[model samples]
Target: MKAWLILLGAMGACAMLTLAYQAGEGVAEHRCEVARAVAKDAARSEAERRDGESAAGTAQLHDNLGTQLPAMEAEAHAATERIRTIYVEAPVSGVCTRPDGVQAELDAARARANAAAARGL
Candidate 1:
């Protein structure tokens, strides 16, 4: 009878240990699933934010193009007119001798051109 009782007690302990291990496994799986779901939600929110910013930028570009196109065209036409006037009002009507101060004049003109180029217009 003593041996039978000892064996029965050992079998019960083994069954309890098995149950505990299965419960731990279930809890671990639940935690992993929850972590995956949270990560997916975070990724979705980030993509949505980027899409919203892109849409806003596109709208702003469209609005600016509507207002700036005409002003840019007018500036271009004015620049063309100024170039034509400069050619028409040139000092010499035909080929002439190089002047004494021609080098200084040429240097000044080059400086002005460089300044304009730097200004992007």
Candidate 2:
């Protein structure tokens, strides 16, 4: 009877040890999975933050362009008019050394003016 009891106790101990080892392995696997999930979440959050910042900057640029567009158009108009006046008055003033260059400049200025006008600037 004593021998039987001792054998039974040994078997139980072995079984407990095996269960403990399996449980430890399961716990380790769960910890690794949690760590990976946390890292993925952190990366996603950082990417979102960067995207939001980029979007905000883009929006600001658009707003700035909207605000300055009228002023820029006015400046372009003034430049075109000035260039046209110069082109017309150059021969009268006798300062036009190169008529071709002057003509090219005038053409560019007129094109710019036409573009701005067409855009309702």
Candidate 3:
């Protein structure tokens, strides 16, 4: 009779231990799931912040280009007009010979070209 009581007590202890272990596993799993969700939320917020900053930078670049383009265009137009005026005012001559200054300019341009070619430009 005493041996039977001892065997029953041992079985009861084992049952309690099994139940405790299962409850501990369940709590650990729930905590892990909560941690994963928090991490995902943090990553999403960071990505959104970086995207917002990138969008703002792009907008700023567009605004700068919009303000500067008309000024650049006007300068280019003025340069073109100056070049046209120079060509129009020059006298037309029957002689094929170029003036001394023009010849010097041509020589300099040829030298620059030769130098650039030497450098494989």
Candidate 4:
């Protein structure tokens, strides 16, 4: 009888521990999802800001909006992609703050290009 009780107790403890671990993992997954959403939001905001800048009444702003913006945006986008690819490597998977900014820059570039196209440029 004592042996049976010990066995049951061990099983109960293990089940509790397993449940706790799963809960922790759930929290971590939620955090990752939140981070991804935040990055996406920031990228969107950057695109909006760049589009606004292109509308500025300045030659340098127009030149940047028409040319340099696209190139810089491309580089930033590449960095974001690289960071994402590296993260999906299984063990250490995630995008950090750095990628967030770069992604935003790229998005802004796209916005600028679309604006220029609209102007028949």
Candidate 5:
């Protein structure tokens, strides 16, 4: 009878230990889930902040362009008017020769374009 009682007590202790281990596992899983949710929230918040900053920068660029456009348009109109006033001499013969300074002007324009490209503009 004593041996039977000892065996039953051992079995009960093992059952209790099993229950405790299962409860610990459940708690660990819950903590991992909570951590994952917090990390996701942090990542979402960072993305929203970056998007807001980008939008502000875009708005500022548009404002700057809006302020500058009228001056640029006026300059273009003046240049066009000057071009209309210039008089070119007629060719002496039916055959036309290339105009003087055309090549130099083309070279200068090309240099300016290259400089702008090098400056990333």
Candidate 6:
């Protein structure tokens, strides 16, 4: 009877661990989706807008995104951060690190690209 009880307890513990891992993965994925969309879209929108504008007419518009892109990127990054997943138990995971960097880089790149486009690049 004692051995049976021990066996049952061990099995329960294993199941719980597996469930926790799966739950963490699922939650992390949701976060990644939002973050990826935000960072990527900022870049994507800028690209589309640049494409819509002639190289000789977009420089000013490129500079203008500064007012708008940050909010979207911040929202996206926040979504990513909602995941409780952690690497090495850090407060922030590596999965989210790229999105954080991407927001700034994408915004800056879009600005340059737009400016260059306006200049007829």
Each model's lDDT comes to 0.88, 0.89, 0.88, 0.82, 0.85, 0.78
Per-residue lDDT tens digits for candidate 1, residues 1-121, read 9999999999999999999999999999999999999999999999999999999999999999999989999999999888856653354546644567875787688789889999999
**Decreasing TM-score order of the candidates:** 3, 1, 5, 2, 4, 6
lDDT of 3 by residue, 1-121 (tens): 9999999999999999999999999999999999999999999999999999999999999999999999999999999888756553443466454666885676688789889999999
Segments in model 5 whose C-alpha atoms lie over 4 Å from true places: 69-96, 99-121
Candidate 2: Cα lDDT at 53: 100
Cα lDDT tens digits for candidate 5, 17-69: 99999999999999999999999999999999999999999999899989999
- Local distance difference test, candidate 2: 0.89
Which segments of model 2 are wrong by more than 4 Å? 1-24, 97-121
lDDT score for candidate 6 against the true structure: 0.78
Q: Give candidates' CA RMSD values in order.
A: 8.0, 6.1, 8.4, 29.0, 10.2, 31.8
| Clashing residue pair totals per candidate (backbone < 3 A) | 0, 0, 0, 0, 0, 3
For model 1, state the Cα shift of residue 55 in Å: 0.9
Of the two candidates 1 and 4, the one with more favorable TM-score, higher being better, is 1
Clashing pairs in 5: none
> What TM-score does each of the candidates earn?
0.55, 0.53, 0.55, 0.45, 0.54, 0.42
Pitting candidate 2 against candidate 3, the one with the higher TM-score is 3
* The candidate that achieves the highest TM-score relative to the unseen native structure: 3
Colliding residue pairs in candidate 3: none
Model 4, 2-117: lDDT tens digits are: 99999999999999999999999999999999999999999999999998777665767777689888898999999988985664333243534445466667668878988999
- State in Å the error of residue 50, model 1: 2.7
